[model samples]
Target: MSVDPEDIEPTYRWPVPPAGGWTADDLDRLPNLPPHTELIDGMLAFVSPQTMFHSRAIDFFTWHLHSLAPQGLEVVREFTIDIDCHNRPEPDVLVVDEAAILGMEQTRFPAESVLLAIEVVSPDSVARDRSLKPAKYAGAGIPHFWRVENADGRAVVYVYELDPATRGYGAAGIFHARLKVDVPFPIDLDLNEITAKRRRAE
Candidate 1:
């Protein structure tokens, strides 16, 4: 018998304020959860069920990223990055050096090793993905960020590159049909292939 993920409830919950807040160590003590749970600013946030289009977008980008990643870097999906004591975000896709993750024992990947972080927006995660994550990733010194959003049944890739002097990302470009970026690595992606058509209800 298989348990439905939706039927399962989180085993742990953060204590209310006035009580001590949750830490990265506290998060690590919890048992494994369904892949959709994330720690944001010391609070646990549950991601809602993803649309088929969202899953396809992640898969599509992961495939192309893996194929075109720089020689020593690898692309990973739904991986946790330990940003600080209070924040551990699992990006939809991230790029890291192959050597940096070798023989790692920690449950979360170190932010220092991350090269690029990408988030594909879901309705439930719109605010966190668009606002919270971008600020946090830049502050952690991650060099690149990409946000994939659905616009009229198509994928729109928004690219950003970090400026060392300012410690913030500068918008590179936004692509509709095709995504092309030269920093970190060269990438050319077709948005059409990754987008899924919404099905009508019976």
Candidate 2:
């Protein structure tokens, strides 16, 4: 069920970006840009459709983060962080200050308000999840980041903490079955739940 990236050009009429490429604010104004479209270095980066593993992993993190996060922190999914004039990439899940709750109408969070940003790696976004986006988040001073990948159909999370001295992230740990962290707040989770389907309420 995966379409070749080259095939999109023939079947889709993408919005024309402006001179010097699209800005962060332009994400709201552009018509025809697909949902979850991101601005990277002033260029639009379209994402592939989600797999069930992606959705389940997001739910697992969102639910646990919501239940355990300290006061004045909130968990949000698929919201863009306004990094600067030209870059606005959306993380799959984010933890931000309660101040980021500007209102129900708020469309994006400022990068400074983000405490932790997490990306569940998609087959199409492996490069961004592993490198590009993390560098951008680090440059904006977001304190923590986690990249989750499917390893033999299980979620394997790579945890990172920002190093202000270098403006880059340092690896904290890699969790195959359990995720335990103390920075930003204490959090312990059973990573296996990401692969287990939630029972439908009948």
Candidate 3:
């Protein structure tokens, strides 16, 4: 029988890391898996079940990005990025060059090849998405990052760009209603369309 996503638990704790630490190869040995699993600093972190609102937001943003992305770039969802031997994160949405994506053999893409990494926050992922990932992605030298948060049923986009000297991201702006930015590419997004409310049950 198919399992309802909501019925599943939020996170799974993997066993302690081995002497050499958890690597991408370790992920390959696992059996059937859910849609999202990440290795952060040698620890396995399972993504929580997504709410209808969260899933819709991802689809909306991904569609807009696909439509507006620059030539030779493609947007993908939940793609694993190998930041290092001990750190592989799966962002909610990511952008990478078509050529780089085509050349990749392993399931995970090299962090340096990504143009932008995006995360859409859920209640369970607030800390990792808001703070942990920004620092991790910046340290890996990914040039751009975007974070989407849902507040009171509206979507908010936070933009960031890497500062090469510090290897960290500097805030560009927080956008609502409309999102406009120039980094990795130029694009404008309508948050209203992206975060349209779902129908309520009677």
Q: Which candidate is the best by lDDT?
A: 2
lDDT of 1 by residue, 88-182 (tens): 88999989988767665646689999999999999988999888999999999999999999998888989998889999889999899988777
Clashes per model (N, Cα, C within 3 A): 0, 0, 0
Give the higher-lDDT candidate: 2 or 3.
2
Instruction: Show the lowest summed lDDT stretch of 10 residues, model 2.
Output: 8-17
Q: Write the per-residue lDDT of candidate 2 for residues 30-88, one digit (tens) a residue.
A: 87778899999999999888999899999889999999999999999999999999999
Give the best candidate by TM-score: 2
The lDDT per prediction is 0.84, 0.93, 0.85
Better of 1 and 3 by TM-score: 3
Clashes of 1: 0
lDDT of 3 at 100: 69
Which residue pairs in model 3 clash with each other? none
Give the distance in Å from residue 174's predicted Cα in candidate 1 to where it truly belongs: 0.6
**lDDT tens digits by residue: candidate 3, 86-144:** 88899989898777675555577888889899999999999999999889999999999
